[model samples]
Every structure is written in structure tokens, then in C-alpha cells.
Target: MSMKNLDRHNRWRNKTVAFRVSPEEDEQLEIFVKLSGLTKQDYITRRLLEKEVVVQGNPRVYKALRDELAAVLDELRRIEAGQGVNGELLDTIHMIATILNGMQEEIAYGN
Candidate 1:
């Protein structure tokens, strides 16, 4: 058995919840977690609990954002002129936009 873990509230986390996702879904999840600068467990927990995942501005997150943007650009370039855009790509773009907007607001407010 694995060692027990405690949450920020000092509560024991003894239960294990597992679910399967498609490879594509797993990739997307990983991208979001990295961008948020949170552990996979913490990001999943906050998302499952309907809590806001507030991303802190950090070097790691900045790197992830830069890499993701580059990947997105490559994908866009690969698409044929008449081909439809990928929904996942749109979703990723929206997410990145939201994060950037929030960061800008934080800077504006001197937070």
C-alpha cells in the first residue's frame, strides 16, 4: 500500500480515485497542469472540487506557456486551408487567453 497523504486542511487523504482517459485527453490534462504550475493531484483535486485553480506567475509556468503557444502555432500551420480547426486546439487557445488576461489584470492591479 502507498503511504498516506495529508491535504492543506490537515485531513488525511486515504482514498484513491482512478479514471481512464483517452491519450489525447491525458495530453490536454498534462498541459493544463503544467501551465497551472500545480501538481497533477492538486490540479485534479481543485478541478473536481469546483475550486478555482489560481495560477501563480512563475518561471516554470512561463516556460509552459511559451512551449504551448509554439505547439499551437505549429498545429495551425499544419492545417489545410479548407480543413476545419481542431476543437481541442480552440479550447487550448481559449485557456491560454484566459490565463494571459488574468495575469494582465493582476499586473494592472499591482497584485
Candidate 2:
């Protein structure tokens, strides 16, 4: 079959997500599914694609981290605006950004 015909036949949703769970777990899932007032597929899709729950963490830790990041960003902007170029400070900021990116990913995935 041609690519055009295949795309038209399957539309955009040609992928499938299949998994198996125990009967007891299935019953529990059904209860929550009914309570959510959404079909099982829609509920599961939303939960997996668009997170409904956030990972738990201490508020103090988040606040401190955010403050530190904001300070770094402010410093970065100031350094960029200044006549002198500070390579070391810029490298430090880049490293911190990379580490924070990893931490964000870990928190998002509940790791």
C-alpha cells in the first residue's frame, strides 16, 4: 500500500498502548474509572499523557531551589549586560541548568 493510503486509512491515531493487570487490580481501576466520569481509555490516556497528580516533595526544598535558580538567572542577565565576559560564571550557570533539568525530569517521572 502507498503511504498516502495507509495514512488516510489509519488516521492519526495508529498507535496502541496495551498492558495487562491482575483481576483484582482491574476491579479497583474500574471503580476509579467510574468515579472519574470518563471512559477507561480517556482516563488512562489523560493520566499517562497529561499528569493529573504531582509528585510529592517538601515545600521548603522547592522554595530554596527556586530562589537559587532565580538568583542565578539574575546574575546571568547582569553578566550578559556587563562589558566584561565571564566564561567561568557562564559555565557554572550552564552546569546548574543541566543539573536542574535532570532533577525536573526525575521529579516529573516520580523517580
Query: Best-fitting candidate, measured by TM-score?
Result: 1
Compose the digit string of candidate 2's lDDT tens values, residues 1-111. Answer: 445433324655446789999876675566445434455766687688785723233554355446556766776688788756555445545544554576689879988
Find the candidate with the highest lDDT and give its number.
Answer: 1
Model 1, range 9-108, lDDT digits (tens) per residue?
8788888899999998999999999889999999999999999999998999999999999999888887855567888898888889989999999999
What candidate 2 gets wrong by more than 4 Å, as runs, is 1-11, 53-111
lDDT of 2 at 111: 88
Model 2 alpha-carbon miss at residue 90, Å: 50
- Lowest lDDT block of 10, candidate 2: 53-62
lDDT of 1 at 24: 89
Question: Which pairs clash in the backbone of model 1?
Answer: none
- For each candidate, give its TM-score against the true structure: 0.91, 0.35
